[model samples]
Target: MLASLITFFLIGLVALVVLGVVLAIVGAVFSAVLGLAGFVLFKVVPVVLLGYVIVRFLAPKEKRLAQMERKLLETD
Candidate 1:
């Protein structure tokens, strides 16, 4: 009986360890997804916005853009 109890305890311990490993894997995957999303929003978005801003300012303004800027300034 004592040997059976010991075997049972060992099996329970092994199950717990397996569960811990599965949970860890899930957490890691979610964390990686969040990290990628954050990098796209924080790093890539700004780089794209900066490039657009420079192009908009340096290139010749179309009549529409000029009119919008004028309206914005008037509002201010």
Candidate 2:
């Protein structure tokens, strides 16, 4: 009976270790996904948006003049 109990205990310990390894793997995958999302949200999106704004600002003078005139008319 004592030998059977020890066998059962070792089996249980092995099961727990397997569960822990699976959880760690899943957590690492989620961490990688979140890291990529954060990089796009915090870094890539802002750079793209800033570049868009800069392009608009550097557009043709005639287009800017039209926008300025429109703004003036809207304020009146």
Top-TM-score candidate index:
2
Residue lDDT tens for model 2, 13-45: 999999999999999999999999999999999
Winning candidate number (lDDT)? 2
> Could you tell me which residue pairs clash in candidate 2?
none
Tens-digit lDDT track for model 1 on 1-76? 9999999999999999999999999999999999999999999999999999988778766865898889999999
TM-scores for every predicted model = 0.60, 0.63
Candidate 2 — what's its lDDT?
0.98
lDDT of each: 0.95, 0.98
- Candidate 2 ranges with C-alpha deviation above 4 Å: 56-76
Model 1 spans > 4 angstroms off = 52-76
